[model samples]
Target: MSERPHMSSTSWRRSQPITSGFGAGWVLVIFGVLAFLLPPGGTAQQPPDPVPPVGVAPAAVEAENDQELQTIFRSEISFVRVDAIVTDEDGNALVDLTADDFEIFEDDIPQKIESFKLVKHTGVFDPDLPPPGTIRNEFDLEREAAREDSRIFVFFLDEYHVRDYNAMRMMQPLVDFVETQLAPTDLVGIMYPLTPLFDVTLTRNHEQIVHALRQFKGRKYEYDVLNGYEAAYAHYPTTDVEKIRNDVSLSALKALAMKLGGLREGRKSIIVLSEGYTDYVPPQLRDESAGGGGRRGAMRYNPLAGNSRMEESTRLFQDMGMRANLVYTADIANRNNTSFYMVDPRGLAVWEYDMSQVPIDHETDQSMLRILQDTLYVLADESDGRAIVNRNDIGPGLAQIVADQSSYYLLGYTSSEAPTDGEFHEIKVEVNRPDVRIRARKGYYALTEDNATRLMAPPKPEPPSAVSRALAKLAEPTRSRLVRTWVGASRGDNGKTRLTFVWEPIASGQSRRDESASQVMLMAMSDNAAYFRGEVPSRPGGTLPLAEFEADPGELELNVAIEDEYGDVLDRAVDELVVPDFTGTDVALSTPTVLRAQNTMEMRRIAADPDALPTAGRYFRRTDQLLLRGEAYAPGASPVDVTARLLNREGASMMPLPVELSAGGAYELSVQLSPFPRGDYLVEVSAASGDGVATTLVAFRIQG
Candidate 1:
């Protein structure tokens, strides 16, 4: 193993000194020493020991026959896997060591190593092998991520804890790291504090990652609401808002770790770009409201104001709560074999607060700076990872991160104690080679008896057929196409089917924007004859390009040519659709049309207009209401009963939706979205006439 000379911290200091009151060089020197002391491979100083676990209460044992059956269901041996990185004094990985050169222990008892292998990955694919495929869905992501040669990395950009200027300075380094340091096979993802874990997908498209990073803007002390989530708490006190931010970030971190754990048991990395976290805001900067201007008059600068007994107690409690949350987050990361590489974007930061923005004494500023940096250190150290702090040049630290994940040893063994008490067990790894440091997970928590039993339980039952079909509708359309289209069939005159074709241009952000879709040349043909052939010009706003024609009920083939503004075709597609037979004697319902409105007035207008255009979009904001319109028909004027109900993604009924008969004779179902959370839901509409019954489902997504 060879070490990169750029990994040295000695030359990371800035040439010029900070103009802040404190001596910036002195603070940098302290942090630099701290960084070198850990040396990336191992932590010389361990965090405070966690509290001992309490013993589980005794429980009655099962019958001998049942115990034997359970034993057959569960694994006879409890295996523990540990990933260790052995590096020499110069921080170069030692890959030559074998199982004979290493020893392992659990809870101070020596255990025999049952499995050992060197897992080395350069993040570069072999030229001899074909290039990997793009990750388009969850299946692709999971398959690619499971490859041993592919390294998974996630960038958790905590914008709430970083200043805008600092974030700008750090963006180039991040982009460079992704563009130059990473190979084409590496899987990378970028996430914000509020981004849902399901929304994150790791891909090899480095350009997309770079584009997202370029748009990064931090908001450390600023409290303007940018989205619906922030709007909920944007008016709170500054201190409370800070606490909320801290909670949100920590929770996101834990969730990411868990998500990676589910993906694979191999080592994964989450690089957190943040200044640091603090639950308590300094007195000088705290305002009555987060978005309000500074308090009236010159701010009081009392460095010792928080030193009183009451204030000190309050600070102590807040610190305790923050520490507890950090411990929980670290524990989750470790359990998932995920490492957190903390990077303070405010490289060589000298002051916690900008004097120009807020009036603060030097002492308070210095103290707050230390507290924030301490948090970064605690998180990194607890997770057996390194913290890059107080360094002007972060390129070396970033390189070291790649080096750490490039090569390592994976070892597994069955625990000698085989305890199922649901307690944390300490692990120790040692290498016989001289001058080599071994860094591995400190330990892992054992599963309780009940947990073990549940793990061995039978697989879950499959979802209902109706639920499965509804959820399947949530699958996204292929984004490589030029436009998104919708087709519907309803009852037509003279015992024929009325086929409606609607199309809209896909957003430029979602697809290639080289050419805008102007119109669609549509040709609908049945087995016997051509029903329609014409051009549908695109319209703006709520109205879209729509074409309707009467066709015989059967398989209809559609050839659509998407054209540009100049009438030149940009793309073409062929679709085979089954036109429903609404002219039959059985009870039947027409394909539902979804119309979105911002308020009741808009909804009423849509209901009144029989020919109002239906939206092709399936995504709606929480404030938007959807009106579903369709026609229910029965033979010989026999009255047809129509009803509607809301179902969750899993197919369970959430609530009953009333179906109203409009004066125009159209059955309409109005859905208010504000009461629902952000997710995919289904609206099931059914029509019944005597023994004949027909049903249809409409699925849509709610966005925050």
Candidate 2:
């Protein structure tokens, strides 16, 4: 085993930072449900439409004839995929162009287009088939999203820049776009400025997406603190706070763009509904006091603004910061092949700020409005998207988004440079025909050396050792957990092994089960001989039972049946356990048990009481804390030092945790789930003595 990472003074385990193709300050958790982990030697399955059949037809009819085909490039470090949408001068899609009519260039050098296909999506599906919204699990969602005819659209509702009135007014237009323009097979999801990209999922359920939009309310200019991020800087002046909001929203947009890019190398659209952003807030509107006192103050003018020169200097300084942020965001969008359709919800606005509160001159207001509109234009133009500003009616622009996705071309080329320097490479696509317009991604970020190797490596073979295979099996149970259980095997009377099983009903919110687990019927068998059988609990969310059974030392096969109170079986599982004789081993460690506490009071009681048994459940919430207890023994009563470390779902080590000695030859460790994201993890405990070392692993999951 490798040396353990230094333990922190805090009880909780420290998080391990993950770097990827995305730019700096982006933390990608290793155990995310959607982590892009491909098998060794196996390439990822691209979307079906990217390799449509070679034929020319009207854009409307080509989508239906898209055949499932793929052009496999030679094993290389990277497969560059670009999505391009060509149109005539009148903004009509040009779908009749062939591969010969287009050219691709990388860093001013023309590159061979290894594969070309005119991809089109009508979002049509069989009426009898269920929509993607019916995806109950992650597998179903991925399957539905990979379909050739499915269109992915994410609504990045930037409430930070949108006012309350504008948010309500724009809600109808967005709803109309989803209900009228989007096909049944289209996958649409809504995200906010603060929404975690890991939690964002594009689904085909249009009704649910629309329902969520109906409740949308913008928080612009509202200083009343809501989340922890806001509370941290609530005391800052309104102007400074607004700058922070812009930083957060822009950072999130860049992160969202990279996330969509990782899903598939197809065209993706993010509808940005906002009133645009500005670096300068008029001095009169900058509230130094909390709760926005300047908005309602009798004296609206800033007393600190003694001269016009000072005001101009401050605005200039702020505008520079805003420009830098906008450039960073545009780079991410271009690299990720995602387009941002900026829809100014304010429509044809005359002023950027309200006169009643801002008290700024009309001339200054007009200039600020123009600056804000230009910011929106730059974002759309750089990402090959359109900015719908200075228009009261945004319905047409919103509809144009659907038309753009209805027909497009997907081009795949292998980069001749293959640079592992981790720098951005520029790409340019052009059409040979005259009087035609072209729009495609500007470029992409090159993969690092480590990332390139991982992508090109083939799938690894399964480990031959039994322990390695058994540890791998632990992650499988997480896929379907009607009842979360914890099993512990220790010494028993008469040379028999003592097996303890504790179980509780997993909350329905955690799983998609309609039937509630009321009782667990357990049957224990050693080879062909029956040992113990009984029902552990009689009700859900009630006190659990620590059911123990004695069995002869050997392999024990246990069958568990999860049933409702009426005896209807909801789920079943067969677990094989090897009961070891502790007395014969020179050094041994008992199976570590976990005890969960909902609050500080419960945690204290669990720690103080030696008789307190570990919870036989594995799933826990973020608000909960945990206490792990186990015992180690060695020959001649030699002392044993125990250590514990956290592991990700793939069995990769994350960080080490502090293990303290408890009374009666036992070891205890405390864990706080608040620092970790919701996912599957393992706690590996090892006991070292003079003669040898003993180890055990326990798997658990944290819920939000």
lDDT of all the models against the reference?
Answer: 0.76, 0.72
Q: What is the TM-score of each candidate against the true structure?
A: 0.71, 0.69
Candidate 1 lDDT by residue in tens digits, 1-704: 11011000011111222111222223333433322211111122223434334563223222443455555434332567788999999988998989999899999899899789898887678666656877876667767878877888899999999899999999999999999899887889999999966677898889999999999999988888899889988778788889899999998898777667656767889999999887866665566778775452223365555445665466567777877778668767876678899999989999987855655656656767887898898788777788999998999998888888888898887777777787878999998878888889888667677766665565577766756655554444444456667787788889898877888887876664467889999998977999999999888764777998999877778887888999998877777766778777877777788889988899889878878888777888899999998888778778778888998877778999999975323698899999999998988888787887777778788977
In candidate 2, stretches whose alpha carbon ends up further than 4 angstroms from where it belongs are: 1-79, 126-133, 289-300, 303-307, 416-426, 444-486, 499-588, 593-694, 698-704
| Full-model lDDT, candidate 2 | 0.72
Residue pairs in collision within model 1: none
